[model samples]
Target: MDLPALPKPITVDLSRAALIVVDMQNDFCAEGGWLHSIGVDLSPLASAIEALETLVPAVRSAEVPIIWLNWGNRPDQANIPPGLARVYDPDGRGEGIGATMANGSKVLTKGSWGAELISALTAAPNDLHVDKYRMSGFWDTALDSILRNLRVDTLFLSGINSDQCVYSTLTDAASLGYDVVLVDGASATTSPQYCHEATLYNTRQCYGFSTTARDLQTAVSAYPDTCKERS
Candidate 1:
């Protein structure tokens, strides 16, 4: 795969890089999930899931840590405040804390299948999982601590809702002085096409570089040493 060159060269150290996948949960991707029950389209997520199915293993082959950043609220929903609730349901559809969707999965509530990662994606034994209450994984989460402890400085971000959760996390990572790359085609948006394009534009112009998963896979495969594969 021919890699897309950035405007300028951006050096990414494989040893210190991490790949983070955001919000690829049943609630967001599966047909019977909460979002689907609420009339949100799950079609866009298919490509992202497909890319990760292959690209994640390529990343592991390169010895880069794969972190799953997902929305998994507490069962009590105590961390969710009025603002977040309103954003989730502006029309007041009674989809607040503890409210179950038509599919019987409570949105964002922990211990619910809806909050779990979609069945198609599995976590490797060495992979990391971080539950987030907000759009940015760093907000009220141990994401930063985990990255710091692992000495990770470069991040490749891909997943659902490119305009929201993905962008939010990318921005936060860049602000924290981490090198961020938004893996294009490995992310999706239920919103209009413009929303996805806008995210790529903004992320590239303001936050980080953007490239496809194929490009990333090629880059990872070029690493000089044979990194230890995860068991």
Candidate 2:
């Protein structure tokens, strides 16, 4: 498939960097998933997933920790307040707390198919996993703790819904003084094309930087390895 031209990626310090792939979940991409069941096209998601299939391994080879930042929330979803709750199923079309599609895939509850990562992206055993309740993984989660522990100062970001969770986390990361990079080719949204464009614009102009997978590889290749052993 012919992919669109992505913005040039910025070179990052490999030693202090990590690739944070956000919310590539079944509910948003798979055919019987929540978004697919609701009629949203999964093409954008497929593109990101495809990009990561190549990017994940290369980053891992660099010993850059790959954090599978997903929405592994409480089964009750008690952390989700009503204001943010409406976004999932505002129309009440059999899509709410505990709702499931015809395929027996639970909608948004934790431990359900909808809340799990899509099968496309592989989750390695050593990969850091964090279950988040909100769009921004930094909010009320162990994200900061994990990053600090890993000695990560630069964050390489990709994943689904570029305009939402990806955007939110990037903003916070920038505010907190962590150098942020958005891999546009690996970060997509089913929202309007303009939304994706706006995200790229805001990310570059406000948060940190925008980039492509090829450029990212160039950046990763620049840094020399300190300790070859994976932590």
TM-score of each: 0.93, 0.89
Per-residue alpha-carbon lDDT of candidate 2 for residues 1-231, written as tens digits (9 for 90 to 100) = 111223433444566788999988887778888787777888877778888888888788778999988876666767878756666679755565456678776666677878887777888899998887788989999999999988889898899789999999989999888988888789999999899999988877777777787666555554357643444
- Each candidate's clash count: 0, 0
Model 1, span 1-231: residue lDDT tens:
134635445667677889999998888899887667778877887888999888988888788999999988887778888778765578877865457877677887887878888878888999999999988999999999999998898899999899999999999999999988899889989999899999988887888788888889888877667444332
Query: Relative to the true structure, how large is the alpha-carbon lDDT of every model?
Result: 0.84, 0.79
Clashes of 2: 0
Best model per TM-score? 1
> Alpha carbon lDDT of residue 216, candidate 2?
69
